[model samples]
Target: MIQEMAETLDDSGSAAPRLKQTKQNRQSQILAELNRSPSLRIADLAARLDVSTETIRRDLDELTEQGLLNRTYGGAVRPLSTEPSISERHHLLVAERERIGRAALPIIKGGRIIMIGSGSTTTHVARRIAVELRDITVITHSFGVATVLAMNPTIKVLMLPGEYHATEGANVGVHAVSFLAGFHADFAILGASGLTVDGPNEALIECGAVYSAMTMRAAETVIVADHSKFDRTFPSRYAGWQQVHHLVTDKAPSDALRAGLDANGVGLHLA
Candidate 1:
């Protein structure tokens, strides 16, 4: 029966090896998204899976609590801080990142001026922009972001001047802020170390300083983070609830936090 199934699939332009790989990949993708946002609402999971909400809720609940997720109003979401090395980050939560990257792609219109913050998620967004968006201008303090976008010749890249942070691979300090102040961008994609019900937060004082400068100059700002970051507080504060324009998180937000952001006029985009 397995042989016959493979033969049938082969006739439909998918060989056994390819078909099996595709199935494995699809499973991996779903798992990755779940890992990124363990506490995603059931409705959000159904939307992502194209299935009924009940089914998703049941399946997610059965998977033992893996520190990756926490129960929410309807489903689960990822945790705030998962310490993974660069390679590990790339390997895990891959499907979720791809979905996030795709969703963010349309926001980066061709020929528009944009600025990207540093982090694993931001780095993925930058790479996707390089492949999909064209004839644009990007100013970033992240060495990784600049390198990722450097593949495109037409897209002008500006590396902000500042002291380098080894772990973040991004620039910081007065020089970075000074360069950002001179030019305005149509959009800004940023990341945060900690997420709270109130607003975006960070751990480093220098990061807070530069992000504040970037926000002031950007016409629109988008905060990208996985759902797990919710309900956590960091040491530094960057933007208050009223300052952000949009937030792209891995899962639907809690009602209270959602209401808080809405009350502050920040649009929420749950991926």
Candidate 2:
């Protein structure tokens, strides 16, 4: 019987793991996923990491207790402040931003001039835009938007002069608004911190004036936002919904929101 047992153990290959999954390794992975998205579901994390649900639950519990993440019903999210920094927002709602960026591409086809708004979603648009024309020109206040679009050798980048907000990685203030006064564009692509029924709004007072100027200078306005922006209001209102010709987003708005968009003649493009 001992000889048979020894032979069976040897035939089973290796009985011990070459590398073990430690608590530190699991916690690092959990934090990484949270950084990539605003929220991460426990079940999805378990499936991706090849761990049991109970194991993931325990990991989340420990992480939350350490103040690294905040738990929702079944998921975890980054602990955000009243105003999250640009670095903090860069990876948030990645899929939603990609879809919204693709949806807005048609609006830029055959355009001579385009104005880009400053924000992470608009930054995604700058990255995703397929440059078909060599003579196309882009105007903006965002350092990030300018840097991304500059990757295209054929496109001309016009950066507005203003006071730089280190956190936003963009320029804003009276100087930016004044510089925008001298130019005109065929279309203005704007991003908002919040999109209420009344209009598009900005959380940062610095961006409010310059964004308002951008909207006024362009002939057409398209607001690119994820569903997370809806029903939220900020103090500074940049432009009314009637001024917004198009709204591109990943999720459908509520019936009340639909009526508001209809009343203002804003075309909602579901990505």
| Backbone clashes under 3 angstroms, per model | 12, 0
* Tens-place lDDT digits, model 2, residues 144-178: 99888877888889998888999888898888989
Best by TM-score: 2
Q: Candidates' TM-scores?
A: 0.68, 0.73
Candidate 2 wrongly placed segments (more than 4 Å)? 1-81, 130-133
lDDT of 1 by residue, 1-271 (tens): 1211223346677655522223334334556776653334567656765657776655665442544344444555444454333444455456766677767776656339998887777888888898988888998888888998989888899999999877667789989988887899888888776677778887666877878887888888888877656666666778887888888777887777788788989877766
Give the range where candidate 2 is weakest over 10 consecutive residues by summed lDDT.
1-10
lDDT values, one for every candidate? 0.71, 0.81
lDDT for model 1 comes to: 0.71
Highest lDDT model number: 2
RMSD of each: 9.7, 7.4
Question: Candidate 1: deviation at residue 114, Å?
Answer: 0.3
